[model samples]
Target: MAQLLACFRRRGGATASAPDEAAEDQQQAAPGPVLVELFSSQGCATSPEADAVAARLAQDSTGEGAVVVLGFHVDYWDYRGWKDPFASSAWTVRQKAYVEALRLDTLFTPQVVVQGRAHCVGTEQDALAQAVRDAPRYPAPAMKVTFQRPNPTTLQASFTGSLRSRVEGPGGASVLVALYENGLVTDCGRGENKGKSLLNDHVVRRLEKVAAVREGASARKTVSGTVQFPLWDGFRATRCGLALFVQNAALQVLGVQHFDLPDNV
Candidate 1:
């Protein structure tokens, strides 16, 4: 069995380094799907135009290829007239790190990080389109995840996989398990979504760390947890994915996955 697993891993082109390095290299090697990270705030009045542009780009079609867009609600604008409910201090710090890494003095409301290397104003239509068109592709991770639901309201998922690493580094990597609930409606009386009943897909409500993958080694960790939703909303959990990426000392996402989550759960 072990021998078969090893063969399978090799056949699938598994890597030994952190997934981020592998992914970065893969993107450089081939034209893969572009992952667009939009940094915006609900409190910023200038963000809506950028948000609209992002939404449109997400819906565009480039053959069978598609662009992945992630909306990171920044909290820096909370001190204004409204406090964004989706804002997080971690996100604010993350943006600042990007600024420092890129050597910039100020951060804006609609900043977009493209492919971990390029940054552009989110509302710039020409720049956004060009970035998407010329975006480099990365290699997809060989991590296979299985989610087991013992009941209607609970799920148990176990992940076992290896990411291609660039070097033989020490310390196991960190497994970040993020759970996003789709079809969320918020009546925002204050923030950016204010006065608008926004229907958001892939809305991340819970982000949890299930385990710590050891360094210089591949991991096969299993985490069991339950998410109970009341019978009133009849809302079901739609998508769940595990992003196995390598982070620098600054905790920036060197590489990431916008993987598809199981819909039945």
Candidate 2:
């Protein structure tokens, strides 16, 4: 029987580190799907344009290199007359981690982080495109994921495989999984976006660290976990998808894989 590695929950306060360029260059040379993360808030007037850009990127599939888009709604703008229903403080912390890793000054709306390597204004299509184009490529994590619905409002996922990239030094690597929704429409009644109809896709609803690869850990291991969803937030298998990525201690994304929720889940 294969040994199931113990997985731990993610904790706050870990200092973020910059990417290691030398180690990154030694990974697989093949180009893999690019991860484009958009940080925006519905309460911000400028977010709609960035959301539209993300939607366009999500629909683009003609290019040889694939792109994976995830929209993270931050809660900082909630105080501006109207609270964004999709916003979460966790996403804000995640963005701040990137800010610290990239040595940025502060947070801003409609920001895009590409492959966890670079950031730019999300609404600036040219800059976003350039960042994606310049981002380093790596082979996909050789893993297989299976989903199970142990109960309504809860999702159980089991993953097994080897992380194709190498991990050296103190903090090891992290296996992060995110649940995102598509085709969402919101009507803003107040705030800067008052009376505007906002369309958002690839909105990240839940994020979890299912497994951790400690320093000197084996290359291949099995891990699983359950993600609980709020009853108020509807879960439609057809409208939701999952994205998993292997990120090293320096905050560089080593590999990525995406999966659509099975209709029956």
Q: What is the C-alpha lDDT of each candidate?
A: 0.53, 0.74
Best by lDDT: 2
Write out the backbone clash pairs for model 2.
none
- In terms of lDDT, model 1 sits at 0.53
Q: Compute each candidate's TM-score over C-alphas.
A: 0.65, 0.83
Candidate 2's clash total is 0
lDDT of 1 by residue, 30-83 (tens): 333455667887787767677777767766634324555667778889987678
Error of 1 at 26 (Å): 14
Q: Which ten contiguous residues of candidate 1 have the minimum total lDDT?
A: 1-10
Model 2 off-target regions past 4 Å? 1-29, 62-64, 168-170, 215-232
Clashes of 1: 12
Q: Per-residue CA lDDT of candidate 2, range 1-265, in tens?
A: 2111101011122211112336534433445567889999999999999999877766663233467789999999999998998999999999999999999999999899998889999899989888878887665555556666677767777776566556544798888888889889999999999999889989998888868887655444444444444423666877877778878787887677677666666
